[model samples]
Target: MGKTLALVVFAAALLSAQAPAKKTTAETPEARAARIHKQAIVVDTHIDTTMMLGRDGWDFMVRHQPESGENHVDLPRMREGGLDAAFFSIYMPGTVTGPEAVKRALILIDHVRRLTEQHPNEIALATTAAEVRAANKAGRIAALMGMEGGHMIDDSLAVLREYQRLGVRYLTLSHSVNTNWSDSSGDKPAHNGLTDFGKDVVRELNRLGVMVDISHVSDKTFWDAIETSKAPLVASHSSMRAISGHPRNMTDDMVRALGGKGGVVMINYSVGFLSNERYEAQQKNVPSAELPRVSWEKIVDHIDHAVKLVGPTHVGLGSDFDGTTVPDGMEDVSKLPKITAALLAKGYSEQDVKNILGENILRLLEQVEGVGRQLRAAASKSD
Candidate 1:
């Protein structure tokens, strides 16, 4: 009996030793998203926190909570969000115009530049796509600027040129109201899109390598500018009208046309832009504190819509941070990694997500710069 028991124990030990090792499980969606998001070069083309620089109790170095009413786009949250570059929107109210507009614009520009200067170790001002890439390689954030309203140019080509010299990259043709030249979507048509001078402005922007933004322009002006400009355009912070039904959002036709030109539509995160219901409620004097928050999924819906219409290469995140009310779970920039995960869950490949994150805008920048060089060379030849 003792010999039989010993034989059985030996057989069991042998069987255990011969068993194959356990198979490893495939990567989870969250894990894959985290890895891809970390490796990707993330860029948000617009944020409106430059005007908040130097305000009481607001510091870009410290991470802020949304409840504090402090502005977004701080260095800590930017790093947390894996954001490599962003275009700081230097915005003045649509009412501010003429020389006063120019003054406010300069002040805001100086504020952002000074902040970058003060944090050279953490961030650098990037004027070109190459500079943005270099800044990413150096493990620092790239800070770029865009003038939010055409009025900032003060109706002077000289002012526009000076702004370009000052490193202003894209010009949003109008704000809430029509500029002296270009008409706005928020107000009644004035010049019926772009005037003769408006077309000239688009040409100059092309020559200067400044991207023409159609975020607030009327449909006629948008069509006019798209036709007038030699390079691709950027709707820096707009959403899909089909889903949200906001007048400010772009129509499906607009996305198709813009994508045909190789342009991108960086989806906006403002609740107003994402949901017509919320916008109408807010407009009806409903207190925001009592209103339900807009879901973050709406951003992905818009992104998916644009991607399906124009492919993934023509989509990106604009956020419009610090400029308006963002959707839920996106109260701060640090939650940006969620965007990557959401896109993955929606069936976007890693490469597609990468393109939507930053590559598309970088390509747009390069194309804009290329168009400028070509136009300048042709002009020199004519001279």
Candidate 2:
């Protein structure tokens, strides 16, 4: 019996020595953050890289850090950030009008397409939710397009339809100024909301499967859009006005209304949108370098507020990269994992994080496309 016990003891010690250390339940926030960021389908619904491509001759193929150059997004940074998908904005300033605007819009669209074409192995143009998933599965970034203003369509549904045909998926009804059909938050209220034509624009967008983005629209216009859209709405890049009190940010009521309709509000990383103090400082001509850097915590605060008001299903990231000045820690796209880490640190569940990262937008896209397919089928049958 003593010899048998000795043999068992010897065997137990040998096994203990051979066994790998058991992973602890407590994972370092950084390690956990990296895992979540990598596993999630991180999609930014609004990026102005298309404009950068058109103006700066920025090379999308090479990674450009913010410190090294003016570029905020590029292929390498996206990969480093674990950004699975992004919608490059075909943004025309509100001041540009007439055929020149349309020409510029077309040029930006062509630029985005050319970038994807040139970097076929690195990025793929995704027109549908399935395509986005496929791109992610194949380890390629899904590149999608969104028109930043309805003015680019030039008061014509035909131009809008043509943009849809050319793979423009979402249209922000206005930019910093009011369009003919829709009032902008940054401009004096003209129609008090969407004009008669604006309602029609929403309907046409619903039929075409293009998302109606209300980021820059006036509050009245936001309600008009909520009442008008058949499909779920998307605030392509806006934060909580209740948090920052900025006109560009959505009010609590607006956030709830959007969430009620099964839409998602992609939180913008713009310092102006994320913090009222920073915004006011900037308005007062405080040198950007003199201004206090907006913390990652503030960004998380916006996300938390939105989630509290609308639940996690309605919140997502929209960074607004290459379009606006980003916050301190999140200087560029490559620092995106910091968001996941911050969210995790706040005790957000993995599933909720997944939804917020990309799944919510993907589900909304699929539903919007499904509606479009049904409309097309019905029209064909009538014909």
Whole-model lDDT values for every prediction:
0.91, 0.91
Q: CA lDDT of 296 in candidate 1?
A: 85
Report per-prediction Cα RMSD to one decimal. 5.3, 3.4
Candidate 2 regions exceeding 4 Å error are 1-26, 55-57, 287-289
lDDT for each residue of candidate 2 in 1-383, tens digit (9 for 90 to 100): 99999999999999999999988788777887888888999999999988778666667778776987586898898888889999999997999977899999999999989888888998899999999999999989999999999889999999999999999999999999999999999999999999999999999998999999999999999999999988899999999998788899999999999999999999999999999998888789998679867886788899999999999999998989989888877888898888888788789998899899999999889988988888778889999
Query: Least accurate stretch of 10 residues (summed lDDT) in model 1?
Result: 64-73
Over the stretch 157-270, how does candidate 1's per-residue lDDT look in tens digits?
999999999899999999999999999999999999999999999999999999999998899999998899899999999999988777789999999999999899999999
Looking at candidate 2, the ten consecutive residues that score lowest on lDDT are 54-63
